[model samples]
Target: MTMELGLLKALLNKDFYEKNRGLRCPPEIFSKDVRKIKDCLDLAMEKYKADLTTEDLQAVFHATNKTMTTATKVSYDDLFRKMQSTKAIHGEIAEDALSSLFQQYVGEQVAQMGFSFVNGEEESLEPLRRLLDDYKNDFTPSIRVDWDDISIETLMAANKQESQWKFNIPSLRKKIEGVSGGHLIMVGARPNTGKTSFHASLIAGPDGFAHQGAKCIVLCNEESYERVGARYLSAATNMTMDEVHSNVSLAAERYDTVKQNVRIKDSTNKNLSWVEAVVKHEKPDIVILDMGDKFSSKTSDKTDVYLKDASIYARNIAKQYKCAVIWMSQLSAAAEGKVFLDQSMMEGSKTGKAAESDLMVLISKNPQVEGADEQDTQRHLNIAKNKLKGGWHGVLHCDLDGDRSLYTS
Candidate 1:
């Protein structure tokens, strides 16, 4: 749209006029008809020590042209009416108008220079050099952003995990303060490190997320839904198969409590997009991806690139669905036999996967001494990365009952 009127109205503001008037813009910048009005404003700006107004400019215009005919006066009055109706474009918008005008002027000057050269009226490139030198430092960007609130009230509300879904594991809860909706938690471990059981414990064990009223969906690719569901059953009932068979009624009752809220899906060969679709359709409060790496199809690029894309997708799903996505991954062999683990030990992956995680817990256990055949129940939850409560990072000890898919502090 035509910014002529807007520019004039913007100049009425003292600060804008002072900042921009240093350009020493001539009447040539305005259209032929509006040049007269611009000249009058320039006169009024100098004459009025306080502030210039449309009425003041009108008085200046009429006073300067006392011998104008009636028709000419009417045309000028219509132009003033147009300018008056136009709302002032101040701040960034006014700056943009001025910049655009300056650019337009520069373009016309360059074009005239080229025309002069073509007609053999110019000799060297000195005119262009002078033009660039004169206007080189004229353009500048002044950006100001109103940041987000840092008030105690807002921080407490935003970082509050008290009202969120609490972790069933006591030791973990004290460290991470539990997880809220729209959180992407990455859990990595080597094979047979109770990776599946860890999620099962947090989600199906007593006072677990499901019992706490979080609608959860487990999409397993590494294992069958029936197998994963069985783990959930054991976790919910806090019983081994032998114990459950001996007391089916008690196990059934306990499992029945959290069964309705918990859902298990056999999502073999499914990608992150499929997971998103299921989450969007079911609208669950929590989603679990068994072996999250399998969700991404192998591509021509490096493993990290596609895995990074997958992790990004998973995070986006959690945020968009407003639910927590628990991504189970396998840690590399380098992390094996180590009591402490970091995000770097994630198998077939790099920082891209870890970077997307809110809380990264890599499971570790006591190394085998070769001769001893005792099963180690002790597990160390390596808090490799924590972007939650207080942002603390450390390890916490917990015992795992693999048979029942449970973890306890």
Candidate 2:
């Protein structure tokens, strides 16, 4: 017969327990109290003399439970069988446990590095990269080099069902066939040129992607949740902020419709690790990082290196999660007062353009022009780089309505 207490106590060995604190154990083994399980294991370790009888284990449990107002009621025999069965299937559980532990380790390390950088410490990411590389090399990724599973008939069927995913904006969508899987779309603009409004319109406007059943999560680091929400409401309802604030009944109705499809997070933490955690948990179809430069990274002191790493990380998130990421970036000061923008105007690094994005769009508007009418304040969406459908370069003109936060073609 298997020694149930001995095996249970061995499984809770100090090193194993420390590494896997949340390891799943049957409730009948410890009466659903983790503390009680630990106490029992401690007693077993102290009093072991080759083997423990049922009476001896019962004595330990009774002694430990005496101090508590309520005793821990566990069926010792039932627990023994459950634990034996668990041991039999330990291989599968152990594999999953190890994977979870590795992911947690990576998250904790990255989060610490981000905090250290944000605190103005000089840090090198070489060690972190090596560690991740080692972990990645352990498993060989399965690639479909041979078409043993696919047939010509199946390929034809799939082609018939294929469709491009697009934003609700007609002109922009027409210029570029909508965003697709693993796509990193970058939008850059000079200050106060309705970049935020443009992103908001994608989620809130009547024709927005959210209406097409796209679940979106917005990470707003530069603005408050209330402010973003206000803008979204105004754009979604085609009403001015003042109108929404004044009409309670209409505002509530519109908000109810908006909240169903989108989640807005206050990303003041500004750390990529936090972003990774949110993306992993929420698994949103669309992730909007409000501004690029504000995002915190492990090598934040080096602007070029940080931008490169951050862009790579963003692209990885899009691909790993099979979601489209819209990264809003700031333009260089040289882009100001210009009617057109190019790839050179991107603020931080060209690697962001070259390595990260599938599409790069620059929004240009002459905000400082004297006495320009609201209708004349035209914003141009310039397709600076298009990787999806090659050889497509052009600009789409949009009329900005600042009051309602709407952009119309």
Candidate 3:
């Protein structure tokens, strides 16, 4: 093979691994030494600073060599030579391998059914069509659907786990189970309707997922890290921002506890792909996007199309990571002064409203009037859409403390 197992091992040993972070290592190349080499590489990287010293490389080589009985010990010189050569021809080798595989497939197909046919005829084009389908299937990676028998005991155990993941809101939690794994919960509200505060409550409130020991990550695009942190501290400590700022030591102590379970990222200018990457790395139980409209789209499509695609991406990320994703969005101008808000009131795209979310919530301040009292505002949580139990919708009322940036049931 042009890309050998030894080459991959050598590349991952030290300096090469950092330089070739984007390199694709084929699993087939390391049939025997894959685990050993990976472990050694991980250890080497963890122990070393930047480049692996001579002693570090030797230690890894000896560890891997000791695990093998039949395989010959690889000399450092030989390994370095192989790595250098592989680096030069890696791209060419991959291209050539794919081309050869395609050619071989065509040859086999032609041999099985003789290629003595007219051009563009159904019989002549059948093999090509099959080839294209096979290629597409091979290249497109997807989550595997396992067809296996499940015991009642297994089902009950899974149910117990699912039951633990619930929304922080009391009425919503009672009406609907918490935001379970692979679910997208969309929160929409009119401007200045305390959408950000509601989400913060879900992360730092006493009944929140984070407070329940679930690892949480919040991506804030519109707000600064300092502002988000202050809000979280205010919510967690039951103190206003002004109080938290004045009592720095007490706020810091409370924040230290909050930081143990939750992570906040400044996601300014970050796209859905960046969010996916963060999810993959952190593997948090819950992910909160402060504002869905801030997420950059993958395509140069229109706003609606971009929103649709972005929502799908968020949903897929939730499923792939087995986490709950709470995405915040804004309501259109038409929703202003309206007592009740539905999916149609969602700004920008209906696809986000119609398809992406597993649960949709609309927030509106009580009275729905201009110049509402910031301190006395009673925020109403409207369950506009709930996929968990069809035909189940209700409204939950909470007191919004503007000073602490908290919403309480």
lDDT of 1 by residue, 179-252 (tens): 87788899998898899999999999988999999999999999888889888999999899889999999999
Tens digits of per-residue lDDT for model 3, 190-275: 98888878877877876677778888899999879788877787888778877877898998777666678888889999999999
Which ten contiguous residues of candidate 1 have the minimum total lDDT? 135-144
**Poorest lDDT segment (10 consecutive residues) of candidate 3:** 20-29
The best candidate by lDDT is 1
Instruction: Assess candidate 1 and give its TM-score to the true structure.
Output: 0.75
RMSD of each: 4.8, 15.2, 15.5
Q: TM-score for model 2?
A: 0.61
Alpha-carbon runs more than 4 Å astray in model 2: 1-164, 298-301, 371-376
Per-prediction TM-score to the true structure, in the order listed: 0.75, 0.61, 0.65
Clashes of 2: 0
Residue 114's lDDT in candidate 2: 78
What shift in Å separates residue 184 of candidate 1 from its native position after superposition? Answer: 3.4
